[model samples]
Target: MSSHLQAHAAELAHGFSLCELAEGLGHLDMDGADDVLIMGICDDSRHAKPGYAMLCLPRAEGRASEFAESARELGATAIISVGIPVDTQLPSLHLDSMGQAGTLLRRMFKTEQAGAHLYGITGTDGKTSVTWMLREALSRYQQQPVWSTGTLGLMRSSDDIRDIGNTTPSLLTMHAMLAEACREHVHSVVSEISSHGIAQSRIAGLDFRTAIWTSMGHDHLQDHGGYGPYLAIKAGFVCDCGSHGGNVIANADHADIRERAPASSRWYGHGLSRDDVDMGWEQELPGMLRLRSRGEEVVIEDIPLGDFHAENVACVALILMVSQDIGLQELPELLSGITAPPGRMQDVLAGYGQVFIDYAHTPEALERCLRAARKLARNRLIVAFGCGGERDREKRPQMGEIAVEFADAVWITSDNPRGELPAVIASEIEFGMQKPYRAEVHLQLDRDKAIGEAVAALAEGDILVIAGKGHEAYMEVCGRRMPWSDAEAAEKYLRRKNSGTGLVSEGEDICA
Candidate 1:
């Protein structure tokens, strides 16, 4: 086991009694139940072990009571359910609601004393980007280890990440990660709070020192029921931070976010009125960002990306200013070397033309990525993208419309069409294209083939963007996840073309 795991194991060596666990949850009366010893806690029956307390929460698959027997078979000493009485031989604790689960887990794990400044970032887009940017900026500014957890994974640094299966992991897993980070002497933690995580109460008990709202857009509507609920969930995170005496940083460019943001929120954005926001940035030149804050401006040169990223950078700057008391003049050196997280505008090949991979699944994200790609393209800009299965279907045609509007050529391919027909998803996206179809568009269900063809079509000075599934290494089809990557597929085609092994017409000279 790792040192942190060893430390956590040592910490949990003295198990908590049933009475102590109940008391920690503010339940004075344990009724006549025996004071069973609990050494570990888990939500999944598969992870249940001897002396462990299995939390039987309702999952999409089944009810809480259904897993009680399995957990009991795995040697779980007790059962904790949310108002669901389990007919099991093991001792059980019935909670009033699901919200109490996080509290109970945090108490058992002692995560509140994790000794790390916690930062929560929530939004439809740019959450991952801002999380990583803040992680890098803070690490450099503080000269200490700063960790971040998000869609990428549990990252100790940019190059060190351990996949924990979700953007915002389950309450038990989240607390465990935080406790381990504390053991590692990590200075702070930047975490991405997803809408599903919020609705599910995954982050129930942890306290944040600062909460960041990157931007809000139409995403996960099906899960949230509508835009209003989605916006409310994102807004509620920052509002809760403010209520807890934590700092709030929001994007002022978003009107709904601005209106809903807390009164004391430190705002950051682009093109907003000078007096409106606490921090702002503008593209002074190509690959250059000029940040304005507190009547002082600092220009960060060699940005290495598009203008859309300026807002994320500005958000990071504002976070340092608010939380770390870092000065504006220090930002140029602190953040000058910061790079975008993998799969969020990752450049793969740049020889004859350039190929970029991005995780742009939403309409707004797709538009921003395409616009950024368009600016970087000296010649034609081709884009290949698709929507995920069982997600917000409303953005399908919207993304198609955006693709046609910005790209010279569009390839709509499959993106994790889990339990949904890839052809149907592609048709819905195609339905949104302009009537005249100003750009050349094609629907290819095979993602690898689409990427290969798109890469082959790129000429000198041209740019090709492979969107959706940026950093994801697997493609979920039906119920199984198959190993896949857009960056690898693009590079494979690029290598074949460069090595004179790719298919070419008669007498056509290969560019070398």
Candidate 2:
């Protein structure tokens, strides 16, 4: 499938003058010639073409004007920047902020999504799973092409999902994707909106027809500055959806979202005892999720996944019910046999106790995955997890605490130690554990050896969960990234153990 909508550069760049673009920012200095006509807007100097207006965004290296010479050489007609003076004679529009300029440019170039309904989901967890399930169910139920973009990148159908770099891409790329979806006549476009994406104004101009709140946690505190700002940014999107007369699906279990969600917003929770909620999962059975709301009940028993997916599946039902007017009773059959996204509670090895792989990088996510794995395990539960380097360090210890609190044994190992030393990162995680539980914790720098240790010790009826690097295909150590797969490693270890092979290979006992 084509990555973007086919639109002539001149056609997409038409109908915007420099003065209107400057005025859109409001109260910005309209330096240079105001009458200069702009055919297109570009943030990167490398993508600048003749008649294109470039945004000189500030960066760590230098001000936006640092790239003005190159942008001018590439036929940029004008420069839009914040506090950067271009050396060229080309007209420049100076703003108080480059983010504001980016927002304005997105608004100018955004295509009209004529027939597509837009759904924006934001949270610390379940954004990817919920969006993926939503797209799958909507496409099958409505019989129209449905598009989704999030942590799994852009997925139009089962065959079209791939990474587009960022969880929520740059505004230019987002608009271009929507334009293509519109041209293909897709029915709905579901996007996973991250806290950073919203904080950076990446989805500035698009009007979402519905928005869903998954769950919030302490992750991304460093990026948003603190938990208060982080929570507010996620809530801001829910508030925006509600005020715009669009449907808002709020998680009734989360107090922050429950209170701020609009009066007309639909809610989903695990319990039916809540009097105020519109929909909820009334019963929890073995390998089944039963939901009830408004005297209507639906039971989905065909799911091969865990209990953690109960809420995500319910969120999909609520979205379809509100946006497509589908009945609650019909949801069970529609979602029958739906599969979880890659690395999300995915069962990689099933014999002699299952080995589940998940992208549970956050404390809340890890806790949920472990608790769900605990329910499935008939005996002991062994968990292997690690913290990513250069991320929110505060959560590292917290995650360590959660792993010990829920699982019978925990294997702490390297998870993309990036620039930080693997041993140093593991030590921080160990800090979160209590003295009594520290005996159960084992630190392994080599991920393959870690999985081998955890998997080899698992007896029949015992479950193993490898967390932190779910769905990822590579490992980042120091500054180099090498091809790696947690699921593949676990399977290989299980195969070797089952064949009566030793857990540790020759010359691979660094953890010994």
Candidate 1 lDDT by residue in tens digits, 1-512? 11121111113535888777776453332444556888887777777888888877656235566687888898888887765556667777767666677677677777756678999999999999999888988888779889988887888865677776678877767777877777788989999999988888778778889999998898999999899999999988899999889999999889999899999999987853387888988986656788888788898776558666777888988999999988889899988868888888888864333898999889989899888888889899999998999999999999989988999888888999999999899889988886788788876678888887787788888899999999899999999999999999988988887787874322111111
Task: Count the clashes in each prediction.
Answer: 0, 0
TM-score per candidate, chains pooled: 0.92, 0.90
Which residue segments of model 2 deviate by more than 4 Å? 1-40, 57-62, 82-88, 93-113, 350-353, 505-512
Off by over 4 Å in 1: 1-13, 24-34, 58-62, 350-353, 504-512
Per-residue lDDT of candidate 2, residues 1-512 (tens digit): 52542121222536567777766574444465566777776667777888887766444126466577677899978777754455556777776664575466555655542567999999889998998888889888988778999877788787766566789887666776776777687878999999988887677667788989988887879988898889899988888888989999988888877766678788888886666777878436645778777877878766546666888888888888888998987888888787788899888875344898999999999999888898888999999989999999999989989988999888888899999988888888888887777336677778898898898888988889999888898999778889999999999988888899888632222222
Task: State the weakest 10-residue window (summed lDDT) of model 2.
Answer: 2-11
Which numbered prediction scores highest in lDDT against the true structure?
1
lDDT of each: 0.82, 0.79
Q: Which candidate should be chosen as best, given TM-score against the real structure?
A: 1
